[model samples]
Target: MKNKSGSFIEWLIPFCFILCAGWLIWHLPAFTLDWVPPDQSQADNLRGLHHRNDVTPGMSGPFGGEADWVDYLALLGLPIFLYIGIRTVRRAPMEFESWRPADRVSVFIGRVTMMMIILLTSVMLYEVLLRYVFEAPTLWANELSLWLAGFVFLCAGLYAMQQRSHIRIFLLYDICPRWMQRLFDTISTVLIVLFAFFLVYGGYGEALDKLWRWETFGTAFDPPIPATLKPTVLIIVSLVAIQAVVNLISDWNAEPVIHTAADDIDQDELEKIRAAVGAEGVGDLDVTRGSIQGNQTERN
Candidate 1:
């Protein structure tokens, strides 16, 4: 009981951290560090000889101060998110050995990738702050951040898949018998694995197009990063697909036991039994009287 209680506490700690991180990310855009106006004066200053008729674009518009400020904040906020993610993954209860071999690698990869994100976040912070704030903004920071985000997303997906912790509504599964639950598990696993495979295959062309075009944000935010994220996406998807296969096999051979319902007496009977057990505290006369009553009832 004590061991189970400790495990429960461990699980709750990470859950709470994730909840808070999500809240902060949701409100990040609403809280900006600087307020800049985008009126006519600001637009005139931003305008340069690059314009054909010397007419300035609207300040605080799409390419205006507000957008850049928000993006910069996002650049800052992403690190906090990455740090929380890393800590959560690192401190996650490690029962991976109990998992299937195929699934174990996915878990390992997910956790390590999380660590990499932390390191990458630090590098990105340096690049962005030094180049933009102190001196001048560099094209590298923008690309680097995007690349890191891509990996972070892909790794997170695999992690979720490995844990079998994805969003699922188990209303029907809750009441299902052991055999039926096993059937559903098998079917679900096959479907998910196939779906991931197709996604990998389909994403390849899009990835290639982005790579060929040497995509850039057409602003101060550009990087020479490769467009080979298709392979990364495919690999992560395949890992998840394999993890599903592992889960399917594990469920196949495992005992189909319901966790909550122990084969003890029902609640009412248990309460009666508790009362009878407590009756030992009464005087000997009461105990003798109860025994006599029980004897008479049995005889009847």
Candidate 2:
């Protein structure tokens, strides 16, 4: 019964997210067409939603309110979407090579970031199709894309740090002894923590103010990008710092790794290619099937 309940919840969360996303997209015409005059054809033709004339001052809902009651329900789903995002990441398979065991928090954020990318792409595609092909453009698509994109960038940074895939020059560190490597790692982690500390210290007040006021983009669509993104930047940077500390502790007594060009190669991708081309086709290439199979065995 416990397992069944758990499985049910697992399915329910994602289903809710899909429903929320679809609801928001469906209501975009109503939510963002506030600038349209009531007498205008566009205003009258928006699936019976009247023009929003009585503008509410300040954010009346979480991360800023939507156009009306219908829109507010979609906004209410944001927290649930965020929770499901975390759960998704925590449950993801750890397939990538990293210095430590997969950080569930970072992985969760990474999956959310991926979803944001897809959402961003869909928004852009929708905008492009409407503006060029259909002779109708949305006021909210650009702003919505920008909003999703900002979160994507911020979340990806934390994921990259957790995966140790962030930009770094290992030429000098590769030659260092294990103790020296540990020292280098410690110094780098300290620097990251300090950077995060000063950033939050300086921006906390401003971020808090914006979030409190729920600052909107001064545009037709009027998204709360500034309100949300400002606080998110500080939050994600702090997570990156914490993940760095975790990595340092996790790697303290680990084996010394030698950096090389081959380290950049993705074995899983190569395996896929080999599978697609078959043994005979792979033989035509430089890499041998024996070596590929050996790597797969070792990885498994």
Candidate 3:
């Protein structure tokens, strides 16, 4: 068991990442809202809730908060993510093998999203406890969960690219010649980049404007969710764009992973089924294999 111990080097790099993220969040004026008196800040708009002051003309979205809950939750959550990232790297180096610098960023953000999921669950539990057990409810819980969930959805796209887990029509793709395969990859990546470019280009100014003006959500618990979330749209798509480009470059020279009729079959899986039913070995599956071949012949 002593051999299982990890050295400081295993965690050092991830620790530095978490530390830098924490320091930056701590220094941001928006997150510093905790230090200021609640009454003085937009957070103080609670208690009465429905006044025209809280729900102004058009600052916030449907939820109505002044700032994102992530500003507060990130400090606590990012370290957990960093720790997970370090462990993942140590345990599954192949997952990140051949990763470029930008790929690492997407992986980091993806890991953070996992941690955020846990925190989001906790927030829901806390809200339930407060509302039922304590007979008190928070104005922020509903809005905060939505805000966190939105980011999780947005960031997962980048993560899927990093993992190469997105859906694809491998039936046609695998049958294509090597040159055609590269052409397909190139075309897919170009389309993704163009889509990302248009999204960022169309939304960048408004999103930045909302964040810069410190826009409010016009709710009693008023958080800056609109300002933060809008900008995140541009940011997340940009990361996805970068990850797409990285994938194209990194996979350009990858050996073709051709799929065959036999490759589509699962011999090991059939063996597992056979064993589960008390078969002695794959030799007991003679009929099964024959039946499969017969079916394929009929299909052809």
What are the models' TM-scores? 0.49, 0.68, 0.62
Task: Residues 1-300, candidate 1: write the lDDT tens digits.
Answer: 011112343344334433443333322222221243234553443232112211222324333433344344445555554454333332233232234455545644565565557657887888878886898766566666676687678878887776665776666886898789888998898898889878877887776555433333444543323434555677788888887777777667666654353533366576666576565634444576678878999999
List, residue by residue over 54-111, the lDDT tens digit for candidate 3: 3232343232343234443555566665655544543233243545767667766665
Of 1 and 2, the candidate ranking higher by TM-score: 2
Query: What is the total number of backbone clashes in candidate 2?
Result: 1
| Model 3 TM-score, all chains together | 0.62
| Candidate 2 displacement at residue 66 in angstroms | 12
Looking at model 3, report the run of 10 residues with the lowest lDDT sum.
46-55
Quickly count the clashes in candidate 1: 1
Instruction: Give the Cα RMSD of candidate 2.
Output: 10.1
Residue 217's lDDT within candidate 3 is: 72
Which one wins by TM-score: 2 or 3? 2
- Give the per-residue lDDT of model 2 (tens digit) for 26-68: 4554454542333455345442432332333333444332356
Taking all chains together, the TM-score of candidate 1 against the true structure is 0.49
Pairs in steric clash, model 1: 131-136
